[model samples]
Target: MIETPGILLTILSFMLVIGPLVFVHEMGHYLAGRIFGIKADAFAIGFGREIAGFTDRRGTRWKFGWLPLGGYVKFAGDMTPASEPSAEWLALPAEERQRTFQSKPVWQRAIVVAAGPVVNFVVAIVILAGFALAYGDVRMPPVIGATVPGSAAALAGLQQGDRVTALGGRSVETFDDMARYARIRAGERTRIDVLRDGRLVSRDVVIGTELQRDRFGNEYRIGRLGIAGGKPIVVRVGLLEAPAVAVKRTGEIVSMMVETLGQVISGRRSVKELGGPLSIAKVSGEQMSLGLDAYVFLIALVSINLGFINLLPVPMLDGGHLLFYAIEAVRRKPVGPDVQEWAYRGGLAAILALMLLVTFNDLGNFGLWKNLAGLIG
Candidate 1:
């Protein structure tokens, strides 16, 4: 039912964006398993029927599946793609048992499970650094170039030449830092510290709210500081410095994600913001249209999200495996298979419900139901 001429572009963009990321994630687990001397039964990209495949010398089946959403590395003792242990795993010969994943030490298993997310974070940081090196960094100082006549900045006695030093106790190193802090607290009162004409002055300002709309017909209430920038000074850093800057940027992003999640959980943010694969496809297509740089940045952002989401303490995920390992380490024995099975079932149900909700949100985002209703009317 996708009638847009750009549908093909969307599909291609989705594949390009997700394919490498999923491959990287699974490869992390594959490499770690090999390093720990655990035997892998299969190293597969995607799920369902295999389109093409080959058996490696080590007896592992490496293949590409028909579906292209996600991938997995199935270790020898894994009963399913979720990496649960099977009866067959326990029934293996004593010699063969040594090579199975479950036969490995708990620490080894934890490392293998944790590697996927760790690699994802590393890859994102590297890619971001590369981009920073290529594009150069924006060196805009946090000085006020101008202020709206009737806006918050003017009300707060912020002059055009005043240099913003800090906001709400956080130091501002760049215009980005000021903008980031300002955008989240519409109509909230905060203290701004500035250097004006060789003197330091502190002023109280109430963040102003403005309604903004996107091309997709979505409207957002965003905080407006009413301060404008003149020109940004661009400086390209050495390769060594790029990685450090990239690490800082990545950490900032992760921090923001954690804060947003906490806000959502505590009822300060709306659940409607959660997205699924459909939303990703839409964004991927949008980024593709914006050119290669945007698309690459999008990939980096999604990669970070993937890595962080996998680390959440939910069963059937990498973090779930680590959680179980933690309990085993504490109690000196693994939880009963029945308990693990029930927990996995509950996790699967929660995941499915969340997927459905996000898919519904995607439909709403696309205006599918709204358009359909309009047509019917």
Candidate 2:
């Protein structure tokens, strides 16, 4: 059970982590629109009823909303928060049309829509690079430091000081490579190549499976090798190489998320693994407790997730706008308004359903429902 003080810390930490990232995301859209001479009606930090606001000299209403979950920028002539064009947009006079989003060229519109995600990616890269320079890179190699007595490695005749060179005939670059393959291929006999005492040795080992609980209390069945890894080496990154390393790390994260989503879709992974806002809060709290470096890393990781999710080709998302622009470019015209409206409605519903599912999972992870029942008793 968490103390009251701990709960407060979690909420405060969540706000500090999420607020800046979200503001940065919206700032991208605002800056892009302003650059292209488009007028913004409002720049909001959250949805729902406005708590406090003021009109800028340029006539944009800057406000903070009560709900504090997500935010949007209302472009001039937008019908809704989704940026769908309304009768207000179409009814604009020739002179006023110059300041509206719809009046911009298709390429310019695409840039404005894509800017939010792009900014998120940029923020993530910058944070990661800065952290790498500050802390250096501590990475573990594929060397086996010790084996569990009478466990898989012991039964397979694997010894300490052995370096894993390949697994199941596939070249292993790091310990993570071997572990990733082992986790998915559990309960199967696998072939491994090890370099020991300047000699290459081949061995067959049965991957062991175990149930593990994450910090959020979510259970996962992961394959274990019955061997512990050696100490990680700290490699300092130069300023010139930091950005490239950051980019590579971002790409790796994207690839992992894509593969995990693919696995979930293909029934190889569970859907409950998807987290929601509550999970974010829990993780933010945990990372904050760990240290500044850990917290900053979480921010970067979440930023990448935010950017990647927005780039998915789904309606009511930035990627959806890009998709429409692509189609318009190909056909030399915009899609029908009725079709776009319906697509947006459907997309909104889909997003809401996904949110509900992940929130339910989060509740279960925290044992909220179970605790409530106990309290009732």
Best-performing candidate as measured by lDDT: 1
Per-residue lDDT of model 1, residues 68-91, tens digit only? 766888888876544556778778
| lDDT tens digits, residue span 170-213, model 2 | 89877777777777655668888999999999998888888987
Q: What is the TM-score of each candidate against the true structure?
A: 0.89, 0.84
Of candidate 1, the 10-residue stretch with the lowest lDDT total is: 1-10
- What local lDDT does model 1 show for residue 243? 93
Instruction: Give the C-alpha lDDT of model 1.
Output: 0.87
Question: Cα deviation of 202 in candidate 1 (Å)?
Answer: 4.8
